[model samples]
Target chain A: AQSVAQPEDQVNVAEGNPLTVKCTYSVSGNPYLFWYVQYPNRGLQFLLKYITGDNLVKGSYGFEAEFNKSQTSFHLKKPSALVSDSALYFCAVRDVRSGGYNKLIFGAGTRLAVHP
Target chain B: NAGVTQTPKFRILKIGQSMTLQCTQDMNHNYMYWYRQDPGMGLKLIYYSVGAGITDKGEVPNGYNVSRSTTEDFPLRLELAAPSQTSVYFCASSYPEGGVETQYFGPGTRLLVL
Candidate 1:
């Protein structure tokens, strides 16, 4: 039961606008989305993944994410927002049955307030 | 490439006193994980390993306990310490490219059970 659902605990953008952080996932087969970024004390920083092809996915500083295979979602984008790009935003889903050892199933974080 | 490294960054146990949270990874990464970040409950997977001696149990492994002979390192063992076992503790490492894998993380360790 791979799960991940960051409905939004906080997300208030301002600096240049355009920012979204909302993910949804529940795997069974074909689903490996991820996007992490934390700051306030450090740890977690890898902002892109959508294992497949062309569903938008482009990570790192500028950030990007799309992969919406009929609403199984994966959305973390940024058009301008700055203010150090806020922080705390995680959404992961990769249990692949757990035998592969790549276990990850998180998503209860989304505090990105980039107001400047 | 320190890639993953964790130690006592901060601690304050008491309840039943017991500790051992140290992780290391120079990148050889066959896999390695141990997570626990509670604020909004984002991360949770108390143990993992796919190399060295091999280990398992994740998704909040009861009070926690782990080990991996050496693929770098992987240690997490908290015998009793309660208070819900504080929070913030992460250590990650990855390998297995192509099939997709990108774990790499470790700048955390802030247990506080008192």
Candidate 2:
């Protein structure tokens, strides 16, 4: 079974300050991790993914995530937060060992509030 | 490309009523999926289709059914609507070519069961 966890229900940060949303995962084999952001009444938009190679992955809207294999974590980060960045963030994981048609397992999600 | 599209942006249903959520994608992806998002529970997969004429259940497939008769369309059916089925339903598609692929999502359909 592949599962992801976002420990924090909400994260608060002031505009221009760095922001981080923590995510951890459990997978049997190599993990394919991804981050998505959902605005109010909107579907989730892809942020970034960690398949292999670099530990750090850059994504849309100046968002990035670091994949810590040893720690089994993929935490989303931004150098400077913007009020517009306030939204719901989710972390998903897929087990590579699973054969075709493997569905992604998502975390409970974290609400990011960037105060202006 | 219109990407993934879902019809009936919002719907209200009474108990025992049935409805089908329509989803279509122009990306020509081989994999399509249906997921439900609750208030604070993130997303849970209800069903998926790897290709036309092939469908399978996901983590939470209790009250939902799906069919994929064409590559572009995959409709999810709710047999007996109940309060537990109220949530935001999302349709997504991806072209997984032997490796990991990104899933493109639709705006989502909000369903409220009374």
Candidate 3:
């Protein structure tokens, strides 16, 4: 079974400070990891994905994530946080070995709050 | 391109009542999915289709049914509404090419079961 875990329920960061939202995954074979952000009353928007590439992957809205294989983690990062960056972040994973439709399994989600 | 769109932005259903959540995509993607988001829990896959006339159950498919009769539409039907069924539903579409798929999501449908 492929699954992802977001250890933090909520993360608070000051404006202009670096923000990090932790995420870890468990999957068989290679893992396809993805990060999505959802605002109030809106569907999730794709941020970035790690599909057999460099360790560090950059995404939309000045966000990036580091895919650490040894740590089994893919943590979302932003150098400068903005008040408008407050939203719900989700981490999803799909195990390439576990074929058949290739559905994604998402984490419980982490709420990020960037204080001004 | 509309990408993905779900109808009935908000709906209230009573116990034992039933309703169908409509979803349509203009991307002509071969893959479509339905997910439900709870308060604290993230999105849970309810159903998915690889192409027209082919549908499969996802992680959580109880009390819910889905059909993919056309490439552009995938509708989810709830047989009997319950309080536990109250959640936000999202429809997404994607084209799986070379083993990498990027799903495009709809605005979502907020369903409240009383």
Candidate 2 per-residue lDDT, tens place, B6-108, comes to: 9899999999999999999999999999999988897888998999999988879999999999999999999999999999999999976436778889999
Per-candidate iRMS values, in order, are 8.6, 1.1, 1.0
TM-score-wise, the better of 1 and 2 is 2
lDDT of 2 at A85: 99
> What is the TM-score of candidate 2?
0.96
- TM-score for candidate 1, residues paired by index: 0.33
For residues B1-114, write the lDDT of model 1, one tens digit per residue. 668889889999899999999989897988888899888888888888889998888867998889899899999999989999899999899987668778989999999998
What is the model-wide C-alpha lDDT for candidate 3?
Answer: 0.92
Give one digit per residue, the lDDT tens place, for model 3 in B1-114.
978999999999999999999999999998999999999997999999999999988889999999998999999999999999999999999876546888889999999999
Off by over 4 Å in 1: A1-14, A17-29, A32-65, A68-75, A78-85, A99-115, B1-11, B14-16, B19-34, B37-44, B47-56, B59-77, B80-109, B112-114
Report the lDDT tens digits of candidate 3 across residue range A1-116. Answer: 56799999999999999999999999887789999999999889999999886999999999999999999999999999999999999999975653556578899999999998
Pairs clashing in candidate 2?
Answer: none
The stretch of ten residues in a row with the least summed lDDT in candidate 3 chain A is A94-103
Q: Go through the candidates in order and give each one's DockQ.
A: 0.35, 0.79, 0.80
Worst 10 residues of 1 chain A by lDDT: A95-104
Model 2 interface CAPRI class: medium
Compared to the true structure, candidate 3 yields what TM-score?
A: 0.96
Local distance difference test scores for all models? 0.88, 0.92, 0.92
Candidate 1 on A22-115: residue-level lDDT in tens?
8989888898888989999889988888899899978888889999888999899889999998889899988888766678888988999988
